[model samples]
Target: MNSPWYIGDPSPSKDESLVYAHGTIMVISWMLLASTGILFARYGRHLRISGRRKLLGDTIWFQLHRFILCMVTVATLLGFFLILIKEKGQWVSVAKDGGHIFAHSVLGAIIVCCALLQAWLALFRCNTDSSFRQIFNWLHRSMGYLAFFLSIPTIFLIVTESKVLPMQQDGLIAILSLWSAWIVIVVILFEIVEYRDRLNSKMGIYRVAQNELMDQTTSLRRKMDHNDGANIRSLNEVKLFLFLLHIIVAISLTIPLVVIIWRQN
Candidate 1:
């Protein structure tokens, strides 16, 4: 007599190793997908900062974004492929150990379709001035965000499921901890970028306040020199200050991600 699903064995028909491999691929693949959200959010900031400098053209950023999206597309497709063929015809039986596994599968399918649509948008992308460009950008961002949000729970369900627990040798608790930590890191990074942009905009007000405070100071012994050289030196000092601040911010923002990646090594 055949054994009952989820009770008898996690991998009755297929090799358990392949299932583990699939899980690993899924984790790495989702990382790529998550990056799309970060890049999309950062696109406007990059453009604003480099609008005049033109460190690189917008097209290059577009291409880079498309490249990552393509990788995500392929990875997601491969995931679906594994879902069907990697199970060795035991797809139905595999669901017996479900605790949102089916929900994860359904969300994965939806995300894949969303990814393909975004890819199609890129292929026929409109000019920046065109009316359709805004629509395309909005839809692209919406889909990307939706996919990212749904992916969290989906990943959690798949990674922490009882059947999949044995696959992660590092222990399920650690894996989930890393996932939660990564999400928090992503949010912190986004907030840092947004904060930087807002601060730059308000620097004018800050400068006025500083000048007022300097005017009120009675302890100044000498008259201030506003010569070209002094101005240049002051500008350079401000630039140096901002640059160091950014370096600190960048390091702080990336530490968690660095730790996670290093842990993987």
Candidate 2:
């Protein structure tokens, strides 16, 4: 038998075009597009863009979030098919590396299916005030989170185990680590923003409730509303800043990864 390192069963002649296409598409879809869409969905509502522009009566943020995620779904499907075509519709086996390819295939399949299902669920979601809206929201969030987290592992596997790429694993790992750290930091920042918003809303509610119990003048109520509106506008400006920063950071990290993939032999 040949030396262990010389075994070539798994490293067949690969089509570079298909390989590059698959890698680039998947990287853009998950790292850039999906991240942007999720950010808009989570924090865009806090932003009051100029003139409060609306599309079909939905806020600009909601429209952007929906549109980007829909593109994510389409891109994911295209990437899935490209990889399958590259592999001749057969499961990639990496038993020599502790079944990494098999695991990646399984996890990737789950992520793709969840992504598609997410779009479908969005289409069928009940109206905001419907009694069953909560159920749809729960399921949609659960599936989206599941698919996103699962993709992390699958992405690592592609670099660490897949023999197709000639890129350095350590370099890829370092990049991914930094990218993930940025994501965590961004999430924490948004959490703080959201908490502050909740606190402000609670305080406003308390003031309203207390006023309702006492004799309050119309002018006094109008003044309170004006103050509240000013506060919200300021907070929204902050959220808009964060959102733009997030997009910049995401694009900065994603570009290097895509370049690395494209540069691979």
Candidate 3:
């Protein structure tokens, strides 16, 4: 009798089950949850809802980002221990297996460390008005970006290189590849939007100078005020659209990968 989840064995052995559980947890915690958290922190600043609510003296975006990241830290720790226990606490020797395992292990360790460090930094960050606040922000952003960059390859190694549970390698690879491309495209779109905003601001300043020289300051001021309001609204709409699109796409891509992992033999 074939079980819906376990194709070859209705009852997988303990180690195999551990591997499956670890993989699924990681996919959800990092790929889905962490990605959403990071995206919200980056692109959700201008969102109307962000400032409308507060928790723990922080806005919605900050609260959501912090909560999700804290959950990722816990989930990551759990996944790490599960694998370590499966190996009986024996560290993978890079010398013996100087391949994907080595890369994955090193990268995974760094990512985990970054996660812990980020949580610690967030907890003890200086107040917004403090002079040291900028330093804290820089350190936090740097570590986060580093962890995010490393996790991509580490996750690829998990699906393609793990030995305990057999996976559909080609399918997973294709999915990850497309997902990576999607992330890159979304980031580029954001950059383009930011650039456009800066360019418009410069042009507006130039127009102000020209209007003043032509003794048209009053009319120009009225027109500029109206345009500024419209632009703010348009910018907000664009950002909100992107944020929602990202969430939808992230879930869409994550679901297939998770389902594949769950149903793997």
Question: Highest lDDT among the candidates is held by which one?
Answer: 2
Ranking by lDDT: 2, 3, 1
State each candidate's clash count. Answer: 0, 0, 0
lDDT of 3 by residue, 1-265 (tens): 2222222344654236676677778878877788888887887665555435456676777888888989999999998888777767776765554467778788989988998999899889999999999999999999988988788898888667634225676788888898899889889887777776777778778977777677675776898879876886677678778878877887888888877877766
Residue pairs clashing in model 1 are none
Candidate 1 local lDDT, 1-265, one digit each (tens): 1322122253455344444445555566565444543454443333322223233554444544566677877777776677567545554433364645666667777877887887788789898899888898898788887876776677666545554443332454465566557566655655565565566547646755676776544333122323333443444344334434433543443344334322321
Q: Can you list the residue pairs that collide in candidate 3?
A: none
Better of 1 and 3 by lDDT: 3
Better of 2 and 3 by lDDT: 2
Each prediction's Cα lDDT score? Answer: 0.54, 0.78, 0.76
**What are the RMSDs of all candidates, in order?**
8.1, 3.7, 4.5
